[model samples]
Target: MAKGLNRSKLAGCAALAFATLFAGAASADGTVNIYSYRQPDIIKPVLDAFTAETGVKTEVLFLDKGLEDRILAEGQNSPADVILTVDISRLTNAKAKGVTQALDDATVNANLPAEYRDPEGHWFGVTKRARVLYASKDRVKETAITYAELADPKWKGKICMRSGQHDYNLGLFSAAIAHWGPEKTEEWMKGLKANLARKPDGGDRPQAKAIFAGECDLALGNTYYVGLMRTNEKEPEEKEWGNAINVVFPTFENGGTHVNISGAALAKNAPNRDNAVKLIQFLSSHKAQQVYAAQTYEYPVEPGLEPSDVVKAFGTLNADTLSLDEIAKNRKAASEMVDRVGLDDGPSS
Candidate 1:
């Protein structure tokens, strides 16, 4: 398994590598600079493999800061050959801002499903994540529950989740708006807000921890968190956290729970354009995707790549079939609704 990492170094290595190779034009000897939000540790193995296979040095610029803003500031002079990050909304925002350029890669098109990638060739998804529900096994039955049910008076004062302002929560709410419309989505948000056991505070992991501490009967967390806990070699508490819950996929009848991705795009003015394409292709290949899946606990975006064993044990999920674009497009609305409904008070962004 890949070691955990600080987010910034990941960006630096990819971007730095590109800068090193940017001096020439053959693309083979050139480096590929990458601007990424994927923490460095998660992608180190994949990048290392790319370097070993192609002998192309890579540089990365890790930015926890705004990706779109940095790219925009660089304009046509940016050293970035690729932009990698999570969240569909952020990817769409980058495209809208013109920091990303479309690419024609057969490997990307063949491996990733159409919905997971941009309609145009602008970006491609490499992995998937389901925003499933985690409920206390002893306190709650492991039966079916829809996202809308959190608003029911039955769950009032019994729900825990991250702040609504987060990209993940916003994306999930955006999906809600896409499927159920603004009125229904707002209503659902209001109900869910009313039920918050302890204001929406903490990231997915902490939310799960809160459930273990008896802070809430249920919490909203990613599917990977379960796998991380289940497979944790370092933290004994993660195993306990895993054993304490029942993972549930909400609303499979209409559409599955909201899903998102950690995807990539070509930089608008890539110096090592061909190599950038090759790097993306390599990342999307089965071997790299498998490594990514094992490390991050995310589902491979490639159609046929079976999930890592840890993920499979979580059980099959019914994912929302909505195009990620829809979720990204509605992000602003979700953000506003979250603030209006006061879910933003729970966790700090």
Candidate 2:
């Protein structure tokens, strides 16, 4: 019943228990193993609730990078039963790397929208987060904006963002390539690079800090970070950063807001397959979805569930209907475009 465990402690516990936890064969031992890219704090509550209700024990191995490579290297002996990660790129990458297996469950299919889950059943999105514009409240007044508009000359020298090569930006860039052709998307990348307030330097929260400090007038960030920042008791300044800007939902010209997901997949060599399936199914249920909304401030994947009140304060999310599979397909090209433009080199370059 531990709550709010940090990543380091979680990792330590996982390491200690790794050997004994999976010594038995893949049987119904009333336990499930998870390899997760999500931070320990964000997912701990939901996992705890699952165990409380289902009486099935859970063990987690949390890693920031190389989750797929680790699982791949382990092959059939990998102890992982489920993989939890964020963004379409990572999910699709896991599937491509042969680390994930298809999940063909009727309940899971019914719980999530077709666009949010893999068309072939390789992965399932558990929560949705929009890639949004964080505009300086005092300096910018526009209430509505478009993704194409981020490259407009008007925003030059006033935009802050992370590296163009970051997965979050890549997700949006891939969506841009989907909405606009590759040719048009390349030109847009150049425009956005030219608009950089500084070299893409930090995570999404730092972009908000830049806006708050008057270093930039706008920035690109995911919606959940706003809630996380605004409610952060551990860091009072993040609350200020959250308050300094307004969340503007940006859309493709012919589409709705670009959205990404925090999703889960079945490990290819899952030791506890049935329990793993049950865990994923429970995560897709209304109760688990509610924990996601309350604890993480993310939009639940289950239809009809509203996001937390803090997230609701931002605005309704009219998520674009474009299939994530389509967006993921363009990631390689989008990444190439980032390098071609030298987007990480800053605007003055």
The model with the greatest TM-score is 2
Instruction: Assess each prediction's global lDDT (C-alpha) against the native.
Output: 0.82, 0.90
> What TM-score do all the candidates reach, one by one?
0.88, 0.92
Worst 10 residues of 2 by lDDT: 19-28
- Model 1: lDDT equals 0.82
Model 2 lDDT, residue 50, Cα: 92
As a TM-score, model 1 comes out at 0.88
* Residue 157 CA displacement from its true place in model 1, Å: 1.2
lDDT tens digits, residue span 1-349, model 1:
1334645566556655544544343244568888899888888888888889888778777888787876665556577888988888778888999998988777788877788888888888888899888899889985788888888999877889988888888888998888889998898888888888877777898877888899899888888888888878899898888889988888733867778998999989887888899899988889888988788999887766798788888888666778997678888899899888777664222
lDDT of candidate 2 over 1-349, digit per residue (tens): 3555676577555644553456563454898988899988889999999999999988888998999977765667678999999999999999999998998999998888899999988899999899999999999999999998989999989999998899999999999999999999999889999988889999999999999999999999999999989999999999999999999999888659999999999999898899999999998989999898678788988777888889899998888989999999999999999999999999998
lDDT of 2 at 320: 92
How many residue pairs clash per model? 26, 0
Residue 22 alpha-carbon offset, candidate 1, angstroms: 7.7
